[model samples]
Target chain A: MERTRKPQQERAKKTVEAIIEAGFMFISRQSKETLTTTKVADIAGVSVGTLYEYFGNKEEILDAMYARFSEDVTAMLREVTPEVIRKTPDQGILHILQHLREMLSRDNQRYLHCAALLSQNLPEQHVAPIRQVLATLSLQYLSRNPEYINLPNLPVMNYIMTHGGIAALVHQLSSDDPMVTFDELSQGLATMARHMIEGSRRDAEQANP
Target chain B: MERTRKPQQERAKKTVEAIIEAGFMFISRQSKETLTTTKVADIAGVSVGTLYEYFGNKEEILDAMYARFSEDVTAMLREVTPEVIRKTPDQGILHILQHLREMLSRDNQRYLHCAALLSQNLPEQHVAPIRQVLATLSLQYLSRNPEYINLPNLPVMNYIMTHGGIAALVHQLSSDDPMVTFDELSQGLATMARHMIEGSRRDAEQANP
Candidate 1:
């Protein structure tokens, strides 16, 4: 069974990748209404039967794309060590925001469009993985900073405010004619994050002292 | 024309009010999919023709509801004078958040569900009126505080950050069993807003000094 399954496993992986890439392409160039499975299968150069063997439907394919995006984000975030955060929190945050902006802006802003579409139908279960990854990274950053360690429920707070605020700003910026430049948007988010960190620290200190 | 129109005018006014009220009731109690004009007319004790006389379709009824919500929000914001902001920005923000929470949470979370549905299909032109009102009020609040005056493009910044952030939080909180309580959410938002205000002030002062 093992000998027979290896080649099939490799082929399945390739098909899945192709389907996701095709789905992203369609979502970027076409409206959400146009992203049907048959069209995606045609774009991927795979048979409709093969596409069904992998994904149950269009939403399933979109979910795969979303998961792929989340993995990419998590991999990038892993590089932001505690040391980088300690030396210069502002630059560290700015760097992360820049990376996010680039990821979301790739391929003539296809990722943003796809993300918007996927988000509308995202199940509650799908939100947890991304949120958990983000919360973990934020907690790691805060834990490295002596001033921020003792803040009550720091990870949860970071998750809600940072994720929620930046996600909102990104969605707004993804529009055809965003009011602020990417630079301004990123800076605003960084400032908000810094304030949340510092404010929590101050509050904790005041309460204890 | 005037001699014959008086009674008709009063009857028309009452019918319009009844339709609007029924629309709101349906939106609050039922999902958007269930909110048909036929149902609304039935609830309002009017014919479908009369409902159509007042509203073109379901979207038109939803739009009317949104307008009413906006009017209520504007009236509340109108009372938040610069003096109120000056005395205590944190409390002022908290008060606004509470008002927003109350408005969104009304009628067993009907307003929020209706808002989510309306926002999904909201036209570009429709967004402007509400954004304009929010920007004007934020500008008034900032103008009263000398520290915030020197920030570049203050009105636009306020619009993007305040609207984007608060809208995001509201959407998250609208979900059942939200991770954070209203108190925590409001405090977190107030903290972020204060930081944005103070952070910008510091950046401006440092640049000039």
Candidate 2:
């Protein structure tokens, strides 16, 4: 019984992954309007009956795709964010931005499509964990750095920074002609962050002196 | 017939406003899914026939509300953003943030509801105009201000600033326990901008020195 159930579960998991992959591929090449059960099944090389057993409707398929997109994106960030916790603010932002863009654009069309899909039907739940991971990691960064810890309203500032950074990235991806380099965009943000840190340090010194 | 048509148009305009107001109010208190045309008519004190004349469905009413929200918000920013063009970066951010918060909080719940509605169904057309306005206004500011003109990729910086600002505000509003004061939020962003300007000026001077 154990051997039979394990093989069946593995097959079910593979089928689900194939269907999600097919749906994602379909949206990339065609308008989302043209997607249907039969098309997805055909692309996935599965029968409609098998598709129905897993997904109740098209939206359920979309939900599955969205879930996978967010999970993969954040997991990538989680692995990379902590590595930069010890870097200066500008360098830290630069590293994360570089890593994220490189990884996403590794499959450029897939990344853009998933990003467009999430933006069109974005859920607050998906955003919360990403920001939280960012905030938590940065909080660790701050506690370790003696100088920046002096900046007033550090928690609030961290909130603004993470949220603002996330916002800027999303805007860039969704904008027309989003062909700019992460180098240029990251420079703008990194420059902004570097100055804030310097100014804060100056203010702290002036107050103490 | 001509005389009757004029009053009919005026009366039609008034009825449409009333229905939109009622629909707006309903969404503020209840879930959007719970809204029905009959309920909107009942709340507006009009017959369902009158509501139907202007709106084909709930989504149409939502579109109308979104149009009004973006128009009014951008209009308010247009009036106020220019007033800060000559001011320093921090001061400019402060004034705009102050004015926006004061005006919106004057009708806080309505503002929140409208913002939520728009965020939930935000169209690119609506966002494009606001960013354009922001970029246009800041381009004027940069042209007028000698120091910031040296910044490489001024257009890109403007794009980042405006989109980042808009996104941050939306995130703030939609955030759980969003009772933060504008002063604090503005300070963080203002500091970031101020330093970027100063840094660019320093870099330019050093390059030519």
Candidate 3:
């Protein structure tokens, strides 16, 4: 019975991993328009019916990939502790940037392309989980030390934190400049956050009236 | 002979315009993945040979559409002069935002979708002409009157004048908040500019030593 259950578990794991690898492969060549169960099955070296047994359709596979990707990103953010962020906002932002760059580099361009496609195509849905992670991380650090940042509207700050950071990341990934190293990308994030903090105080003052 | 030439000229003009419109329609629904010459010809109510006679392939049709669409945007920008930019950057940004909204609104969403698809699939050769037009227009207004602003680095300043301005416009376009009006978009641009300018100055001072 133990041996029977072991085969079943291994088969399920292999099937799920194959579906996700196929999904990434499909997105790399084309944007959201080219995704299909048949294409994924063909790429994954599996029968279309077997693929359907694992996923209802392309959207289900994509949704699963999104959930898995978000979990990975969140895990990276969690590795940067509150103590690390307490040192400075710059350090926090740089740490996150380096972590993202390392993760993207490990896949040799697939992760970067997938991240850009998701951000562009499914902004509303895909942004939510990432935004939640950023908000939790941002608030945890900022609330403990109001000296670094003081603002009236927390939601707007959250918006800037998530969108501005992601925008900088996406720009670096999509740029054709091979000489633009990851250090510059990290510095860009630090610059973005510092600018946001410095400006938000004045905006808060003006909005109060 | 003169009369014959006039009629032939008119027919050629109609065929070119019809092909462009059909390309837009095809991109609006299916995107660049499903783009095909036969489908474009069918939609344009022209023969496949006629389509080929006018342009080489789908890229040629896309090039024509991009040139025309970019000119439309330039014309809209020219409608707002340096004087408008001087009165208030926020007001100027608002005027341009509303103009773009109106321009895309006329097509009832088809143009916006087609434009987004084209942006994704644009050929490398098409970038230079568009950049030249944008840079010439942007420098004509923003660079001529530097006393009105205080950004430190000229290159970064020029970059902000182009990328930051466009980013603000795109953010507003993609926003789901119905309550977020053009005025809010303008204010956002102004806010982005104000912060980045300060940050640039800080970087400049650090670089000088």
Off by over 4 Å in 2: A1-8, A30-60, A179-181, B1-8, B32-58, B106-108
**lDDT of candidate model 1 versus the reference:** 0.67
TM-score of chain B of each: 0.80, 0.85, 0.74
User: With candidate 1 superimposed using the best TM-score fit, by how many Å does residue A59's alpha carbon deviate from the native?
Assistant: 3.1
- Model 3, B1-209: lDDT tens digits are 22122215788889888999998888878866578999999999999888887786667788888777777766766666554556444455556667767886677775677755544444334443544555665566576656534544444344434544554345445555522455554556556556655666666767884
Alpha-carbon shift of residue B77 in model 2 (angstroms): 1.7
Query: Between candidates 2 and 3, which one is better according to DockQ?
Result: 2
lDDT of 1 by residue, B113-162 (tens): 66655544444345557667667766677667666677754644565456
Encode model 2's per-residue lDDT on B85-182: one tens digit a residue.
87987788778877777766655668676566556557766777777777667777777776677676565566566767777777677665763555
After TM-score superposition, what is the CA distance of residue B150 in candidate 3 from its true location, in Å? 8.8
Q: How badly does each model clash, as a count of residue pairs?
A: 0, 0, 0
lDDT of 3 at B176: 54
- Candidate 1: regions farther than 4 A off: A1-16, A45-54, A81-86, A105-109, A112-125, A152-160, A199-209, B1-75, B78-87, B105-109, B112-128, B152-160, B202-209
* Candidate 3, lDDT over the whole model: 0.64
Query: Which of the numbered candidates is closest to the native, going by highest TM-score?
Result: 2
lDDT of 3 by residue, A1-209 (tens): 22122225787779778878988988988767667788888888888878777676667788877776677777777887555567678777787777777767666667777754654454346656776788788778877777756564345434544555565455546555622455765665566556656777667777875
lDDT of each: 0.67, 0.73, 0.64
Worst 10 residues of 1 chain B by lDDT: B1-10
> Which model, 1 or 3, shows the larger lDDT?
1
* DockQ of every candidate: 0.20, 0.47, 0.16
